[model samples]
Target: MALLREEDRQYLENLFKENLKDKVKIILFSDKAAGSKLVVPGRVECPYCQQTREILEELVSLSDKLELEIHDFLTDEIIAKKYNVDKIPAILFEKNNNVLGVRYFGIPSGYEFSSLIEDILDISRGETQLSPTTKAFLATVNKPVHIQVFVTPTCPYCPRAVRLAHQFAMENPLITADMIEAIEFPHLAEKYNVTGVPKTIINEKVEIEGAVPENIFLEYFKSALKD
Candidate 1:
């Protein structure tokens, strides 16, 4: 059975045709290719890796402008390190060979699917929906800003936080935004004390609970820099 319904596939095809501009490359660092027989040291069992690859494969087939590249996180250690990817089922968006800081560290299903789609569109257009004021502020970011939005697939408000972080990443290469599925990565969720959905951890210091407006998110982003 197809993960995406036929109706959803058709909708995405039409949507990509209308909105996608430049070519967008979808890169995934996963152990899916290794299958169950192979075992690499330090690499744990990835229950969602295969499903994640299947979804991404199905997604890229919708548009000619979209490309998919799958790399084994263990075998392709050098490549993973280059992209700062240390986890399985990690997704990255690339345009013109430039992999911006927009990354997804889990299976983007349920409501998180919208965040993945919008981020791809944003990368294709090489622009973001953030306000001019936000853009101006992003331009001044000389330091690195890591925004990790911990989410669950069922969270209705998670996409808002994820998309905003992704758009901020698109605005500035120094800002790396990641959407982490809390259920899939329970250890991380516990590490960050993610009790609620749409909890955003910036630079491992600033934490924002719930989905807030763009201005409020930016304010939190600014505070993260001060730390």
Candidate 2:
């Protein structure tokens, strides 16, 4: 049986056909020690697993822009440790030896799937779709900015915030964007007091809750830099 329903497969196919203009290198890390079992309870099955390989195989074959590289987390401890990967099915996108983006825990399914596609597109373009004002403000930023957006798989608004943070990180390497699944990493959620979806923590000091406009996000981000 296919992991994705027939309609879902066609939907994904149409998505790749319409988008995917630049090269997308997707590094998939699989934990052999936890093979076929989810590291986080209730997480989706690993695409490389026997039951789901066909689904991934079909998806990969449909897109020339996407390059999939698989690594066994247990065996390739060095690479896994380098990326600080402690979970299965992690994704890291890089270019010219710099980390472009990351999906730290599980598959970006459901509504988050569109955000995943936008991430790839933004990374491929090597630029962000930030407004001119936001771009100008971000250009003046000299210090490092680390943005972590905690989310759940079911949140509809989480992706907008995640994509904005990702775009900022992609445009400015001094910035790092992390999309943390709230339920998957309970400790993190508790630490940051993530009571709601789309919570953003900047530089461990400034916390912005909810999906604000890009300019508003930049204002909060800039304010954090001054502290």
Candidate 3:
């Protein structure tokens, strides 16, 4: 009684194959009983939840380079608390005690799926394709940079912003990037004044709306560093 349809499974298999070419470990935190906490009533089962698990398990079984770990949030309170995971299906990519990248909420599916794969590649390679100038600027950054990018599922340009923020977080241990679904996290959207898609809030001070190139993103990072 798997949730995934055959077509979806095949599609996901192809995606996993294309994305995971090197060793990558995915730690998936989920609760069998609890639905997505971000959703209301807390009783509705996510249609994609079980299917996502199946897809990850299939990828793990087929690929020697990919390792998948699942934890029930109800049974593993300690681990969940340690990771400070408040959302369901949080994906963490770690290597050698260093948290290379984290997807705070759910799977980055739909158009964001490509962004998720890019994140895996970046973590696996231990490098991002950001320009040298961007790297040089980020290298001098010492303080914690928390970036929250608000996006919708249908937005085409949102992934670029999320990827850039994730790249920053992956390169710098002090940087943490969160991809917030505006509709899913309504309160957060209101709190951050997110009236448009791809709104990026850095360290609660500097805010940039719309998708921009890497250099523009770097400029905002620099401004946030000063605050």
Candidate 4:
């Protein structure tokens, strides 16, 4: 069974066909034993890695401009450290071989699927749909800003928050945005105290509890930059 329905696949095919202007490389880190029940000693299990790669494989199949690269997180410690990926089922995108700061820390299924596609389109077009004001602000960011938006697959409001953070990353190289599936990484979620959906943490300092308007989010983002 495919993760994406046939009808939805057709829609995305058309979408990517019409919009993609540059090639987008999708990078994934996973283990092969994820889909199996076999136990591997001394290695922590990654439950969703296999399914995540499968969905990405299906996704790249929909568009000629999209590519997928899979890596074993256990054996590829150097590569994982290079990308700062500490978790399994991690995903990131690149264009013209330039890796973006945007990342997905779990399966980009459910509502977040749309966010994934939007990021690809934005990367392919070398542009974002953020307000001009927001883009201008992002360009002036000098310090490293890390934005982590905690979300669940079922949350309807999470995509907006995730998309906004990702677009911010695209606008500025110093900014890194991550979409963390709260249910999958309970330890990090607990550390951050993610009690609700659409919780966004910026610079691991500023926290936004809900999905705020674009301008409102900008205000919070600025606060994160303040000393």
Residues 1-227, model 4: lDDT tens digits: 78888999999999999999999999998886687777887565788888899999999999889999988888888999999999988999888878899999998989998899899999999999889999998989988999999999999999999999999999998999999999999999999999999999998889999899899999999999999
Screening candidate 1 with a backbone cut-off below 3 angstroms (N, C-alpha, C), the clashing residue pairs are: none
TM-score of 1: 0.96
The model with the greater TM-score, 2 or 4, is: 4
TM-scores across all candidates? 0.96, 0.82, 0.82, 0.97
lDDT of 3 by residue, 81-124 (tens): 88766666667777755655456465566677677667877776
lDDT of 1: 0.92
Task: For candidate 2, list the clashing residue pairs, or say none.
Answer: none
lDDT order of candidates, best first?
4, 1, 3, 2
- The model with the greatest lDDT is 4
Q: RMSD to native for every prediction?
A: 1.5, 4.1, 3.9, 1.0
lDDT of each: 0.92, 0.73, 0.75, 0.92
Query: Residues 60-149, candidate 1, lDDT per residue (tens digit)?
Result: 999999999999888799999999997778999889889999999989999999889988888998888899999999999999999999
On lDDT, who's better, 2 or 3?
3
lDDT string for model 2 (39-116, tens) is 665443444333223334555666787777778766788988987777666667866556664554555666666777
Clashes of each: 0, 0, 0, 0
